[model samples]
Target chain A: MGNVREAVDSGTWSLPQWADQPPDPDLTGASFLLISYGDSEAEAVVQQWEAGLRRTDLDPPVLRFHASAFDRDQLADKLAEARCGVRLMIAGGQYDVLQAMATARALGLETGEITRYATAYEDLPLFCPHCQTTSRAYAEVFDWTDCTGCHRVLTIKPHYSSQRGSFLGVDTR
Target chain B: MTDQRRLRVTEVRSLCPEIRQITLEPLEGTALMGFQPGSHLILHAGEHRNAYSLTGDGIMPSRYTVSVLKRNDDGGSAWLHQHLAPGSEITAEGPVSMFAPVHNQQHALLVAGGIGITPVLSHASALAALQKSAEVIYAYKPHRAAHVDQLREICHSAGFRLTEVTSAGNCRKALRDRMSDQPVGSHAYVCGPMSMLESFLEIGAAAGWPEYRLHLERFEAPELDPGEEFALRVSGSPEDLRVPVGVSILETLESAGYSVPNMCRQGVCGQCQISVRSAGSLEHRDYVLTEEEKAAGGSLMVCVSRGTDVEVAL
Candidate 1:
């Protein structure tokens, strides 16, 4: 997919975080809290997050929603007033978290500023650089796949795009 | 030989008992290369080279200005304060930048501690010139508030908010209160002592502020224990090189005829980063690399970092 192949091959692959680090101690004082979760498996992680919040002296306004209930328009309205001190915590499958992450980035929130915990593995959301179409595929399925828009076989490299908040799909055919 | 430029010191004004503001002009009378708001200059004087933040307007800089906080042990600052005077010429290099303001942000917040106001001052001025909404919070020791009058003038003219916090009172609470009010899409630039920077970083991360949005500039290297002797194997080398207890990896490689790119050898710059193929226990000493990059074991700054025994992609 254009120059994306060369860029991905030359770039470094960020290792996944297999273990969770302790939550930021100042998270309780966050003025706004946005959380997204998927499935019952994430409930335990969400409950632990809530318990941590309870120990703090400050009580912030929190909006918790399910991944399926993630309404883009509604989240956009809620984040319209998002500011620097806002804290976000996301928990769910990889696909669900990636979708939520895209939304957060669109709202100008940085990845380092937010907390993420994946409860389940899912297909990675990828954007084809050739046709500019988005698709999802499991990492273990194949090294290449057909682009949804261009209908061309595209190679899936390990490179991630911070701007698109997704992996890149380069043309292999 | 280093790419050095000669600058003439035109003015030396004492901002306070311990701080000196020195103004320099390019001797060639030509416009210097333009720089960003948070750029710094490396001054070389009498075997000492130190990085000082440029306090002047970066857009159309006619001259360079830097404020030095004299230290008893820091020979560089002491030397400048004692020997540098009007009409004195000194050699300097670079307007290199390791910290810069986020351009796309709607609002900007700058926090400064002690003498860290140098770069923050430039940020405020740049933001004001861009007509962006910005605020500055400067915390200083009561006795060391040397440029209060100049700072007040800048804030009043730029139409941005300015807050001065003195150490004698509850300044920490005041800083936190201000930080809590930052609007979304706002970026904060911080510089100063390590303790203050750490406090802001910890609190900001906890508040869900993204790491990319919080920029930092540190004047000193992190306190690290001396490293033990180690064996290093560089790519394209035939023999295993021995690094002594006191010698740095950068020095060892340079002395071995390898031209390793570097700036701010104090571990603030990321130029000397090299890939690690295999290694023993690594002692990471640089501020540039992220935690993930460090744990990935693929990259390390050779200038300050050391390991027990390692193989590197030169």
Candidate 2:
């Protein structure tokens, strides 16, 4: 079910490459399409982007947000209308960002077409192999957490499956 | 370059006056690798090598099929046309998937011009097998249109729509309107003359399509103007080569008693990538590198691209 890789700078290969804040995207590349989650720092992230582009004749990026997470229906509607020179950026909880990425990918968005920013990794969605249960845990790669379903201690894997939208929690012992 | 295989021509058919469709299978008993839709094979005949788009399904293909446009040059097509009899053997390199369809792609806007329909045929087969509805716009002169009957049959069988245009103007006029009807996550692939490809790219870009969703294959282009002469300094070496206007960097490197691993000297093969340690300006004019790869400025294809006051790692 897995393969492997090496390690180097920028911390490690497994971690999603993003700063604590979403960096300013190259505005001239493509018109931005921002997807933010609920009333929080994410809303502020959206507002920060909106205010920065008042000068140019660039089309104001369309913002699609959900109260809790991303609304697939609305997201699909907006994306359907999107043309060639478009860039998509999604920001939310780590789990929700992964989910949104998977959904967008399913609709045909390639890595070059989309960008992601995780606002919170504290509530990382951990999927336990033994109990087959998914639970949120304050864990990092190689960290240990217990499954709520079968009560088995699991080690969070470095490998993140975008399709499953969760980090694998392997019970080594 | 190491994995070379010989394939025997199983069948050959004259698609039209200028084009011929040839089917090839393993010369000996061996399983050929399955290919993706829009894959191409670099066929070698004598001193010339050319890449031809496979006009069949990618799944564990028993025989590879390609439709070639006879340009009258010795680069495989003219040779293949000259030797069209069955049982003829030829060496081939790969079923390269550079211009393939994207995975999990919702809809495809396949635009082809003249001989560019070869890959689009493969894509149509793929979309049909998946039972996905797609659109195919083939632009060609009435006499030059290959695979029109086959395309019509595929359209009849599958849910695909086939629209034929006599000129590039008609296709360009129709492309914008057709793109709007696609669902989210759709990709538009254009394999044609440079003008058609440019128009599709322009339309897609103007309409807000991302670079990832817009795919194109350019086998031919108007002759590139000889760039300005520049002196290249090899990193950590005393060698300084003065590259003139008419010659490429690879030829210059060879002339200076240096050997670089390369093929398809015209820059299509991408076998001649070198580390661009530093440069004053890099003019990347190859089909291989992605936008990010070119922007990263680490390596560049030595064949077509040129740099000024550049220090390259030999």
Candidate 3:
């Protein structure tokens, strides 16, 4: 188990790293999607990933595996059972998600293949939910600020297009 | 901002099975502004970016705490438990302002479930630090309880009221009663599992807590209903890429060698901002856009938001 961390740190995961001959990896163990914010972000990110699969024509549908939040033990058990290979573990945050990605990569599982980085967002506009005034923007768009109106923190959003690419908005309430 | 600087991890301790409580201290030679009692930190854990509440006060020695609960079915927790050893260096952003406590409220009721207790733990401590009394109701399944010793110590030392509910049989009933007893000036802070959070909100709403007084930090964002696949036409590319109902646009673009800047892919930050050149309608989920921006259909964060069966040229 500890070796999994080493693998991720060093960027390596082999097929036989955490399993005994690739036992029924998907079935005997459960797959988890431990999201930190809530269901909305989880579903939104999952949906986005599913869409990516179709665009790339990645066979077997990434969504076919499905996503569900798992706790510590549940996640570990699934990884162990997934001895057949390393499974995808998308991260909701940098520290938390990276650790998961690293561990999966370490256990001889393909690091990049098993974990993905997705954003955790509170639903709605770009305004600073705290201050409600200063229009939020990312590093390039605007010098990021917590908020001038309410002092509430603001998170960056990614726009699908190029111009007006993700900026901050106000909280209506 | 000059006020908020990255605090360094001073110490880490295992609280219970699969749970680690991290103590953070301000870096030497850096002027660290104190965090509001209920502030939280964004941990850059490996590839994932997760949020955790600060258990310590905002000011110096600038102690902050985060509790990590191991997952059973995923690789994230195992990696954290195994790799996060003493003296390991990592970066933490903010003592963010997501969990601030209301100053004007007459009575504040704090409810926490499982690891959701992190933020509320600080709230309770803050109320005590301010000499303001608040009631705390900690709910957990009877089988998985942790941090009794530490929680009890904080509760008693802080002089704040505390109630521990173990039996699943009367959990909701107990929460309802405690909430009902509070006066009009009370503000409620609720954090926990999705089901419990929903239940608490329903009961709180029934008891007349305004939507604003009740603050929430969800363990995971809510999922949206899926529909027919949409066409995500990549800019600078000729082909119209089809994004199925449940896939992400970023992955679609990335697989094509088109890079989109992103950090926390859960829609918390606006790192992966893009424009919907043309689309049916966008189901915006990222927290970076202002109301005006979303209204203008000018910009969107592709990390999470999606479209409804239209051509979105990103």
Winner by TM-score? 2
DockQ list for all candidates:
0.32, 0.31, 0.01
State which candidate, 1 or 2, has the greater lDDT.
2
Off by over 4 Å in 3: A1-173, B1-9, B31-33, B141-144, B157-159, B222-224, B231-242, B253-280, B284-303, B309-314
lDDT of 2: 0.78
Q: B122-238 in candidate 2: lDDT tens per residue?
A: 999888887887888899999988998888888775658888899767888878777655666678898888899889888777666767778888876557779999989888888
Q: For each candidate, give its TM-score against the true structure.
A: 0.70, 0.76, 0.54
- Which lDDT values do the candidates have, in the order given? 0.76, 0.78, 0.57
lDDT ranking from best candidate downward: 2, 1, 3
Span of 10 residues, lowest total lDDT, candidate 2 chain A = A1-10
lDDT for B76 (candidate 3): 48
Summarize candidate 1's per-residue lDDT along A1-173 as a digit string, tens digits: 45654655443664245336435434533654546565776666666676777677776665555554345676666666665767677776665566667787777676655677777666666778877877766662236777768788877767666566567777855
Candidate no. 3 TM-score = 0.54
Off by over 4 Å in 1: A1-60, A63-77, A80-82, A88-104, A111-173, B157-159, B245-247, B251-265, B271-281, B296-298, B312-314
lDDT of 3 by residue, B105-164 (tens): 555788888888887877776667677767788887655565656667767854467888
- Estimate how well candidate 1 is docked, as a DockQ score: 0.32
Model 2 misplaced stretches (Cα beyond 4 Å): A1-102, A105-107, A110-126, A136-173, B2-6, B28-33, B44-47, B73-76, B104-106, B130-133, B156-159, B232-240, B256-264, B274-282, B295-298, B308-314
